[model samples]
Target: MILIKYIIRNHIIPFLFACVVLISIFLLQFLMKFADKLIGKGLETIIIVKLIVYNLAWMVVLVVPMAVLVATLMAFGNMSQNNEIAIMKASGISLYKMIIPPLISSILIAILLVYFNNKIYPDANHAARLLMEDITRKKPTLSLVPGVFSQDVSSYAILARDVIQESNELKDVTIYDYSNPPKVNIVTAKEGKIFLVPNQKKLIMDLKVGEIHESDIYRQNVYRRLRFTHHKIAMPADQFTFEQSTPGGPRGDREMGAAQMLAIVDSINKVQSSYQKEFNSKIDQIIDKKFNYKPIDTTSNKYIYVKVEQRLRMLENGFTDVLNRIEYNRKEINRYMVEVHKKYALPVACIVFVLIGAPLGTMTRKGGIGMASGISLVFFVIYWAFLIGGEKLADRDLISPFVGIWSANVFLGIVGILLLIKTAKEKVTLNFEFITKRIPKSWKSSDDEIENN
Candidate 1:
């Protein structure tokens, strides 16, 4: 009992460390990719933070399995390095027994992850998507350049001859207002100041020494001109404002839970079944018409021929429509089933990684983060490649959803079991020094000299 407790305790720190490092890496990449969309949008800090937090749900799902791999490798590798495995084996404790605790822990983790994927992940994805849409819809802070027209405000165009950035002032400003149809209004001001309201829902322009020219398109003779000392124009600035929206819409595959997706697939199956029956009936009707024989009067041969041709054309059109519907339903089923399987498949990877990591760690006999990370990266890449490829194939109806998503786990699980059996039978240690030996002596000398300097 004490030994099992010690073994499980060793994994805790490494798993946590791996999770933090991997999540940080994912977070940095996300920020770099989305900086352009978030910058200069004048969004509240809380909104941005919420967006990041929501997106972290998916990052956690991906990081946990990899962390399991890293933690397993580090814990076992360290024990092997310290010769604890040798001591334990001499005392009659086999590697298989040592694996029981971590394996059980991994199963519990996998269960929690499955719950997280089905409950929390889908909502987070939906919220993040909506938040991103709101951010992108918001225009940047209004910018007006000297001797250029600015149309940032809806239904209004303003041209400024000179703009003072420090004062937010404009000189020799000409405005074209198109909020009303058939009547055109042009306002020119000698000096103006533009600013957005506190709510950011309206833009107000204060004009001084301006003339308003109003002309009606329907009546050329109706022209009015007014000169004013001071005037103010309020324009809609809703596009510049950021609003938090409630989540309410149809979600895509990635935005739905496994149960929801399975339900959808079930419904699609029912629809597809109906479509198939309809298609088969149409085919039978066409076949019957094609094979049936009918008699016609000799004097009415021309009319009978025309009637037969029309009937054939109508039946052909009906067959085409039915076939198309069936194909569409089939595609929908494949797409939803793929997502349903994926929700469970990724969580199951936690168990698979532990199986693979334990054997590899025992063989390598190295506990350092560098070695563990390198090995983990290679395996993760292969796992992800299989997952992505299988998803694509399944979505296209090339493979079954169960086969597409579970293939990686099956392949890796088998390899892990075999390695575990072999390691139990014989002692094996992998030396990586050969890789260092391959480095050029000149390069090594340079590195040594640099270190010395």
Candidate 2:
């Protein structure tokens, strides 16, 4: 019991460390990729934070399994390096028994992850999507440059000969208002100050020594001009306001839970079954018609041939329609099934990684983050490649969703079991010195420096 406790305890710090590092990396990447969309939008701090937090759900899902792999490698490799494995073997404790605690723990983690994926991940994805849409719909703060026409506002354009950035002042401003149809309104001011309302719902421009020119489009001869010492124009600024919408709407496959997706897939399958039956019946009818043809003595040969051709054409069109519907349903089923399997498949990877990590860790006998990360990176790359490629193939109806999503786990699980069995019976060591030798001296020196730090 003490030994098992100690083994499990060793994994805690490494797993947490791996999770933090991976999540930070993912968060940084997310920020960098979306910086353009978020910057200069004048969004509240909370909105941006909410977006990051919502997106973290998916990052957590991806990071947890990889963290399992890294933690396993580090824990076992440290034990092996310290000769603890040798001591245990001398006392008759097999590697298999030492693995039991971690394996069981991995199963529990997998279960929690499954629940999280089905319950929490979907809503987070949906909320993130809606929030992003709202953010994109929001226009950036109003900007006007000197000697340029600014049309950032709807149905209005303002040209300024000189703009004072510090004072929010414009000189020799010319405004064109197109909010009303069949009427042309132009305002020119000697100087003006422009500012937005506190709620950001309206833009107000105060002009001094300006003239308003109004003319009707249909009546060219009718024109009115008025001179004023001071005037104010209020324009709608709703688009510039950052309004958060409630997250409620139609969701895509990635935004639905496995149970919901499975229900959809089942419904689609029933529809496809109906289509298949209808297609079969149509084929039977066509066959009957083809075999039951009888020549009429009163009908000319040309008319008979034309009738047969028309019937054949109708049958062809019907068959094509039924076949197309079935094909479409099949594709839909594949898409939803892929998502359903994905919900479980990725969570199941925690267990699979444990199987692979334990045996490989013992063989490598290295516990440093650099070594474990490098090894984990290679395996994870291969795993993700299989997963991504499988999803694409499954979506195209080239393969079953089961095969597409679970192939990585199966392949790695088998390899892990084989390695575990072989290592249990004997000893094996993996030589990674050749890989290190290929690294440039500068890179190796930098790695060494980081390790020292």
Candidate 3:
């Protein structure tokens, strides 16, 4: 009972502390990326702060696994440094027994992470994404001072001598459109009434007694025209819903449910199937690209030098094509496999990280929080590198998705087992000095910088 309380204080607390610190650090970095947007949007300071806090929650949820690992290590490492672990061992406690509190703690954190990923993370992500879109939408309601024409979007300019807010009317309005290349046009209206398109986000101006003027700069010419009635200018389809290209947007594969993932895969497969004829036709054009020279039958007469050059060019082209196909095939398989397993693999990383972290901390026997964290970071970097390599292979279909996703976990798990054994036995870990001692005599001296200046 006493030992369990010590675990709670020494291990669990430190782990929670680490989680808080890591979440804050990550949140700051995330906020930094959108600092410009916050300013540009002219959002309320309080609102912006609230959004930051909300967004931080999502980051906290994602990094829970890492925090659990670091916290476990730091707590245990502290105990080891203070001789608490040594005392426990001498008191007939096994390393496995010492790990119990941390193991329980880890399971709790994992449950929270699963809950956060499914519920909180999605809500936070959605809010952040919506905020970004709103900020970037940039709808400016400018009050142009009579004669002063304000440049809105590129090629469109607006001016009003006077504006009536109550009636939503403009007097002495002028529009200059220079969107067309090598030409410019200006329209002047004496009176205009504004109309908002229903359910669409476009504002239409009905102008009366408007004179149109045109100019050609390259030819150094000007043309004048007149119109008595109303003209409708094209506006972006913000008011009305329009279909958008959906490669990966807010509702991308990452955020999708299981059904969505399957639907996307099926859709992509359909596209590939439909384009099968196109790919087959590519084979016929393949030979033409290979040979630089015209067909022998068409040319009839080819010099010996031309024949050699053509043959060499064909060989080079063929070599390039072969290399391209090999590279492309490898990448395609790698990506496909990695993506297929990502949802499952990433969440499970929490458990794997904890397994590796616990043993590593015990082995180091160093309690400094920063030092433990640094060690954890190094391990994470190594794990991340393996993931990146596997992902690259899986994305291109060069490797199976299952292999790509679990490869890092498998490698890290084996490492965890080895480290666990070493730490449980308290083996002298291999470091630089250990390796240095095995080097030739020329690499070291007894009196020269040997544990002293």
Best by TM-score: 1
Listed in order, each prediction's TM-score against the native is 0.81, 0.80, 0.61
RMSD of each: 5.2, 5.5, 11.1
Error of 1 at 224 (Å): 15
lDDT of 2 by residue, 21-71 (tens): 999999999999998788766679999999999999999999999999999
| The 10-residue segment with the lowest total lDDT in model 2 | 136-145
How does model 1 fare in lDDT?
0.88
Q: CA lDDT of each candidate? A: 0.88, 0.90, 0.65
Query: How would you encode candidate 3's per-residue C-alpha lDDT over 1-453 as one tens digit per residue?
Result: 888888878866776788788887887798788765555333567667656865875577556767767877787777777878779889989777887776776667666666565555555655656555555443233333566786644566878888765465779988888778778788888888655466546656678888888888886755668676776555443522222222334563335443445566566565555445444445555556444455556645556457757666766676566556555544443443354465455556666776677676666677677767888888778777877888776675666778876888788878876777777786443234675688777656654666477
Look at candidate 3 and tell me the lDDT of residue 291. 47
Two-way TM-score contest, 1 vs 2, winner:
1
Q: List residue ranges in candidate 2 displaced over 4 A.
A: 140-241, 290-299, 439-453
Poorest stretch of ten by lDDT in candidate 3: 239-248
In candidate 1, how many Å is residue 368 off? 0.7
User: Cα lDDT of model 2 overall?
Assistant: 0.90
Candidate 1, 161-217: lDDT as tens digits: 988754668899999998898888999999999777888788888999989999999
